[model samples]
Target chain A: MYQFTIKPLFGTEEWELGSTGVNIAFTNSALWMMITTIVVIAFVQMGTKQQMIPGRWQVAVESLTSFIDNLVQSSIGAQGRKYIPYVFTLFIFILFGNLLGLLPLGVLGVHPFTFTSHFTVTGVLAVISFSIVLLVGFWKHGFKFFTLFVPHGTPIFMAPLIAVVEFISFMVRPFSLALRLFVAMMAGHILLEVLASFVVSGGLAGLGFGAIVSLPSMLLMIVICALELLVAGIQAYVFALLTALYINDAENLH
Target chain B: MPQISQLAETFSSQIVWLLVFFAITYFIVGRGMVPRVMDTMDRRSKQIADDISAAHAAREQADKEEEAWRARENENRARAQALISEAKAEAAAKSEKKIAAAQKRLDKKLEEADERIAASRNDALEEIETVATDATQDIVARLAGIKVAKPAAKSAVKESLANG
Candidate 1:
């Protein structure tokens, strides 16, 4: 019997990943992300055409394109248009990764909820999103984006203290962006997988006397699946929205 | 900060797959896919705008044609009204010519009748003068019991005048 858990296959390993002291171990999260990127590239490329009006594939791409356009406009204003493509890509990639993870192949090959494993996929995605935020900020504002930490109308007497707070706030940008995405994915996956494991246990337990336990587990799996879909959409939206805001802040030279 | 260290000590195993996944997405979509999609969308939007402009031009041309048709219709109607007025004047002129010709003919006939009446009146006056003279002479001769001859009277008046 296979179990679902958030742990790496090589729990105790060390590796040198081209001067970045990263352990080299493959996980399902890595596989899913690879799939997501390939999907995005192919989806965009194949959808491209020379027609005035969009066909089905192009229309599908436009749907996301317009959604991101509106999202950026409402959240960050017109300056957000420049960031739309990147944000849309981020949103779709995260969404698909989360959704596809819910499928049969997402967390397979490894046992569920094992003690030796930890969810590292969320961390890597977090790093990427954070890196983008940092890079985009720097590219747009140079060093002016640092002023984001210092809220307007602060007292001159507390300048040093305010500066320290600003530094801390600036430093936390990556962490915050990364953590928000990582937490949602990690929590949703864990909760759903745990409930699913219980469903199996309950099914085994039910002979006719344990009907009540199995019934609740079955109902719970359905609920979790529904919630998983919502979480996936929300996480993707949050990631894209935050990235756009970061771009907006930088663009405004705030 | 405490939670971080605790997590670091507890489970550092799942970090490797995260890096691999991030790397793949960043390279594929960020570098390759996004540009293609954006380029296509931009091109499509421009093409749609051009199509919209063309449609607008076509609509404007149709409107202009409709306006021209309306103008021509109005012109034709005006020409018809003017022609109708000219025809009415021509009809009045024709009727006026006939009426004037008939009036002139009637006046000429009336003038001829008046001339004939005047001639008859003069003839009657001459006859009446001759009759009155004969009656007067007859009456005088009867009253005097003798007739005076006009030749003798005239000769007597002339003899008197010569002797004087």
Candidate 2:
């Protein structure tokens, strides 16, 4: 049951720029990304007409903003204020991307796509965040930014070994960040798909035996869905928090 | 497997969309939404502070007014009490003056009555002495048949009166 597959919705038609060797094609992942963007933008726009006393929608927006604001402040310190917008964007994008997959769009003959389930999507985000850390680290500290890889107060003989290990660990930050989110989302969705297939295949066989057998799997799917919802939010928060921490490391050279 | 094999094909589109959406969200949420929400919160807190201060000022003003009213009431009461005591003292002085004048007039009238009674008593005593002397003189001339001297008769009468 490889129901978790991602396919190009438009049958793989690529638009080429003449003689430029650049092919641009709209994919299902692109569609969800655009939808996520629209939803986020609309949510922000809805909260634009704010009041001294907020309503339900405004309260939601303000709480989320303050939550991220506090996260950035604590993780990245005061200098992290400027990075709030980027961190907030990343959080909301990943959060909505994770949640959008759980919608049952298959009723309309469309397979719902979660962009975050794909490593490429998360990989780009991780690389972007990591690049900012490196760029800001180098920009602020110049050549001293490399000192971040060397642990403090190491023995003279062990310094080289520690430095190499630290450098590798530092470089692996992006891949780890990307894979953590990708695998979490991908695994949950795949598990749901496997359980759902068992229910469907069982139901197709016989009504009496199938219903009894599939009931527990159905309940387990529900439980997994609930857990997925929690994971979606937690992963987004973790991603943003880690990004801020990395930025803090770069800025403060810790 | 398809995701890994077709990574190159899907990579650019995803990145492009991600950039577009993220940039838009950053601009709107960062520049627009966040500031407005923060401003609303700030304004709300400011309004609450102002309300509390205004209430405090009003309470203080009320307390001052109440104190002033109490002080004025106390002053009016004291003035009224003074007026009452002054009126009482004035009435007492007037009654005392009336009683003293009445006593002085009564004492003068009593003295006049005493002097009139003593004068009358003295006149009555003198008359009695003259009458007694004449009676003694007549008795002596009738009984002894000797012409008694007037001075002798008078002296005899005096002696008889003294012995009696």
Candidate 3:
């Protein structure tokens, strides 16, 4: 579908900055990102009435806010409060991104884009989370932050080998985080696209073929659609949880 | 896939928008709204704590008052018991004194009456003796012309009465 296609809505689809190059053109991905941002802002704003007794909308917003609040608090301990805005931003942004992609806006001829399905997008988020961890670790513990690689009770003889392996594993955090979300979202969308193509192809073939292939594909697509919805929320949660966990390691050096 | 093949073209826009939007969410939701909600929760918890402490104080006060009332009730009961015993002792002593005085007066009256009765008995005896002597003298004189002295007759009558 053209929904996944990156077409420049403003400038030429080319990077031509001074040296490193930057694609300054606004695209469908940026549009969806903007939309999700607006939605997040509005949702949060709706809950900020500061009423002693909250209404339904306020409850909905407060639940999400407190969900992240609790997540950070549990994962990062007392230091978690400082990073709530960051972790919350990552969580709600990705969550809204994933859900917005699955909207039935295609029926109205306005196909929704899932920016989080892109490696560039997920990688950026992962990098941001990783950067925060690095900054917090260094600022709090200096070079001693490197001790995060070695387990507390490791034997001195096995320290170097264990340290190397731990170092590699530690370095893989951002890539794994980016890849998990990107692949999960991309795969589900791709499967839906393939199934949709099959439905169309089967319908064009014949009535019997449509019954055999299109009907089952349609049913399967429905099931997969439901599965994808679950995956969307799960992927967002996993991303946020992993980010918080990584931050925990930096904060507590464990 | 355009995601990989066209990454160069779209990466910058995506990253830029992500940063921009994430900043917006961070400022609006995290900084603006969350503190207010937390404050409300804190205020509610504080109110509940204050109410609980006040209720505890009131319960404690009620208990103290009840204990005082019980102590007062016990004191009054003891005082009433003492008063009842004292009144009983006083009444018993008054009644005993009245009985003792009545018994003494009865004994005195019995003694006086016994004396009076003895005197009357003696007078009657004298009269009888005199009469007996006179009759004896008259009879003797009439029958054999013999006369007896009054004192001798009386002594003889008294001796006979005493012997009888």
Q: Highest lDDT: which candidate? A: 3
Candidates' C-alpha lDDT: 0.64, 0.83, 0.87
* Model 3 chain B worst lDDT run, 10 consecutive residues: B36-45
Q: Report clash pairs, candidate 2.
A: none
True contacts kept of each: 0.35, 0.56, 0.71
TM-score of every prediction relative to native: 0.68, 0.75, 0.75
DockQ in order: 0.17, 0.38, 0.43
CA lDDT, candidate 1, residue A96: 75
Q: Is the docking of candidate 2 incorrect, acceptable, medium or high quality?
A: acceptable
Cα lDDT of model 3 by residue, A118-207, tens digit: 998899899999999999899999999999888999999999999999999989999999999999999999999999999999999999
Clashing pairs in 1: A3-A111, A3-A112, A4-A112, A4-A113, A5-A112, A5-A113, A7-A117, A7-A118
Show model 1 residue runs off by greater than 4 Å. Answer: A1-23, A69-86, A105-119, A132-146, A206-211, B1-21, B99-164
Per-residue CA lDDT of candidate 2, range A1-254, in tens? Answer: 24345556663554654656454566778788888888888886666666777888888887888898899999888888889888988898899889887787888987778888888889989999999999999999999999887768888898889899999999999999999998999889889988888898878879875778677889999999999999999999999999999999998897
Query: Per-residue lDDT for B19-117 in model 3, tens only?
Result: 877777778777777777666666766888999999999999999999999999999999999999999999999999999999999999999999999
Q: What is the C-alpha local distance difference test score of candidate 3?
A: 0.87
**Full-model lDDT, candidate 2:** 0.83
